[model samples]
Target: MQLLAQVLVNGVLLGGLYALMALGLALVWGVLNIVNLAHGALIMLGAYVGYYLFTLLDVDPFIALPIAMVVLFCVGYLLQAGILNLIARAAMFNTLLITFGIDVVLTQLAQMLFSADYRTINPGYAGANFMLFGITLPWVRVLAFAVALLLTLAMWLFLLHTRLGRGIRATAQNLGAARLYGVSPKRIYALTFGIGAALAGGAGDLYGVVSQINPYIGATLTAKSFAIAIIGGLESPLGVVVGGIFLGIVESLTALYIGPTFVDVASFGILVLVLIFRPNGLLGSTT
Candidate 1:
C-alpha cells in the first residue's frame, strides 16, 4: 500500500509535466487544424536553450523557461507565417509532408549543433526530497508540477477570456467568418502556432530539469504528445490535461508492476484501447 501510494504521487507529478508537453500539440491542432510534426523538434530546441542558459550563463532552469519560450515562439511564428501559411488551405497530406520535412531539418540541425549527447540540468538541490504523508517528493519535480499546472491554467484563462484568445478560437471554428469579423486568418494562425510552440518550450525546460535529454528524444516526445492529444480530445484544453495525467499514472504503474522497459508498451497500449473504445476521447462528447 505504501509503495502504491508513492507510485501514485510520482505518477501525478510525472503526469503534470506530461500534461504540459501535450498541451502545445493539442493547442495547435485544435486551433489551426494542423498536426505539427515538428513540434518535438521545437521542444528539443527549447531544451537546448534552457540547457545552455543554465550551463553557460549560470541562469536557473525555471528562469530560462520564458526565454526559451520566447525564442521558440519567434521560431513558430516565422515558420507559420513564412512557410506554413503558404499551404494553410492545402490537403492534410501536404501539411504532414511539410511539417515532417521541418521536423527532419530541425532534428538534423540539432544533431549537428549539439551532437547526440544526453544532458541534464542539475540545480543545486537536484537530489533534494521531502516527505509528505509518508511519501517522498523531489523538489524539482514538485516545482515542475506547479509550473505546469500554472501554465495550463493560464492557457485555459487566455482562451476563455482574452480578445486575442477569442480571435484564435474563432479562426479555428471558421476562418472565413473570423476574417469577416476582422480576425486575420494568417495572423491568428501564426499566433496560435507560436503560442503552441511556446508551451512546448516551457515543457522542454521543465523536462530537462527532471531527466536527460538528447536531440533524438524529440521523436518519442512528439509521438507521446500526439497520443496524449488524441486521447485527451481536442475539443478542449482540459481534455489534454486529463489525458496527460492518465498516461503518466499508467506509465508509472506499469514501470512499477511490470518493468521499466515496458513503459512505452503500456502508454501506447492505453492509447490503442482508448481509440478502440472511446474514439472521441475521454473528455469528448459522444454526440
Candidate 2:
C-alpha cells in the first residue's frame, strides 16, 4: 500500500511537468496547423539557456525561466516571419521539411556551442524532500508541477479571454475569414509560434531542475511531447494537460511494474491505440 501510494504521488508530480512540455506543441498544432518538428530543439535551447544563466549569471533557474522564454519567443517570431511565412500557404510537407531543417540547424548550433554534456541544475534545495502521508515529495518536482499548472491555466484563460487569443482562434478556424476581419495570417502565425516557443522554454527550465540534459535530448523530448499532445487531445489546451497527467501516471506505473525500458513502448503503444480508436483524443470532442 505504501509503495502504491508513493508511486501514485510521484506519477502525479511528474505528470504536471509532462503537461507543461506538451502544452506548447498542442497549442501550435491546434491553432497554427503546423507540426513543428523542431519543437524539442527549442526545448533544448531553453535548457541550455537556463544552464548558462545558472553557471554565468548565478541566476536561479526559476528566475531565469522568463528570460529564456523571451529569448526563444523572439527566435520563434523571427523564424516564422522571415522563413516559415514564406511557406505558410504551402503544403504540410513543406512546413514539415522547413521545421525539420530548423531542428537540424538548432541541434548543430547547440552542439557547436554547448558540446555534448549531460548537465543538471542542482539548486541548494534540489535534494530536499518532504513527507506527506508516507509519500515523499521532492521540492524541485513540486515547484515544477506548480509552475506547469499555473502556465496551463494561464494559457487557457488567455485563449478564452484575450483579443489576440480570439484572433488566433479565428485564424485557425478560417484563414480567409480571419483576413477579412483584419487578422493577418502571417502575423498570427508568428505570434502563435512565439507563444509556443515560450511555453517550451519554460518547460525546459523546469526540466533542467529535475533531469539531466544535453544537446541531443531535444529529439526525445519532442517525441514525448507529441505523444502527450495526441493523447490529451489537441482540441483544447486543457486537453494537453489531461494527456500529460495521464501519460505521467501511466509511465510511472509502467516503470514500477514492468521496467523502465518499457515505459516508452507503453506510452507510444497507447498513443497508437488512441489514434486508431479515438482520433479526436481521449478528452477531445468527437464532433
Candidate 3:
C-alpha cells in the first residue's frame, strides 16, 4: 500500500511536468493552426538557456525561467514574422516541411554548441526531500509541479479574461472575421506563436531542474508532447492538463509493474486507444 501511494505521488509529479511541456504545442496548434514540428527544439534551446544562466550567472533555475521565456518569445516572434509569415498562405504541408527543417537546423546547432553530453541543473536544494505518510517527495519535483500548475492556471485565466486573448481566439475561429474587426492576423499569429514558445521555455526551465537534458532529447520530447496534446485534445487547456496527468500516471504504473522499457509502449498504446475510441479526446466534445 505504501509502495502504491509512493508510485501515485511520483506519477502525479511527472504528470505536472508533462502537462506544461505539452501546453505550448497545444496552444500553437489550437490557436495558430500550426503543428510546429520544431516545438521540441525550441524547448531544448530554453533548457540550455536555463542551464547556462544557472551555471554561468549563478541564477537559480526558477529565477531564470522568465528570462528564458522572454528570449524564446523573441525568437519565436521573429521566426513567425519573418519566415513563416511569408508562407502563411501556403499549404499545411509546406508549414510542416518548414518546421521540420527548422527542427533539424536547431538540433544540429544545439549539438554543435552544447555537445552531445547530458546536463542537469544542480541547485543547492536538489537533493532535498520530504516524506508524507511514508511517501517520499523530492523537493525539486514538488517545486516543478507547483510551478507547472501555476502557469497552467495563469494561462487559462489569460485566455478567458484578456482582450488580446479573445482576439487570438477569434482569429483562430474566423480569420476573415477577425481581420474585419481590425485585428491584424499577421501580428496576432506572431504573438500567439511567441506565447507558445514562451510556454515551452518555461517548461524547459522546470524540466532542466528535474531531468537530464541533451540535444537529442528534443525529438523524444516532441513526440511525447504530441501524444499528450492529441490525447488531451486541443479544445482547451484543461483537456491538456487532464491528458498529461493521465499519461504520467499510466507511464508510472507501467514502469513499476511491467518494466521501465514498456513506459513508452504503454503511453503510445493509450494514445492509440484514445484516438480510436474518442477521436476528439477524453475531454473534447463529441460534437
Candidate 2 lDDT by residue in tens digits, 99-138: 9999999999999999887899878899999988878999
Candidate 1 regions with alpha-carbon error over 4 angstroms: none
Better of 1 and 2 by lDDT: 1
Task: Give the per-residue lDDT digits (tens) of candidate 1, residues 30-143.
Answer: 887788899898888999999999999999999999999999999999999999999997888999999999999999999999999999999898999999989999999999
Q: Which structure is stronger by lDDT: 1 or 3?
A: 1
- Per-candidate TM equals 0.98, 0.98, 0.98
Would you give me the overall lDDT of model 2?
0.90
Error of 2 at 11 (Å): 1.4
Ranking by lDDT: 1, 3, 2
Task: List residue ranges in candidate 3 displaced over 4 A.
Answer: none
Among all windows of 10 consecutive residues in model 3, the one with the lowest summed lDDT is 83-92
Query: In candidate 2, residue 54 scores what lDDT?
Result: 95
Global fold similarity of model 1 (TM-score): 0.98
| CA-only RMSD, every prediction | 0.8, 0.9, 0.9
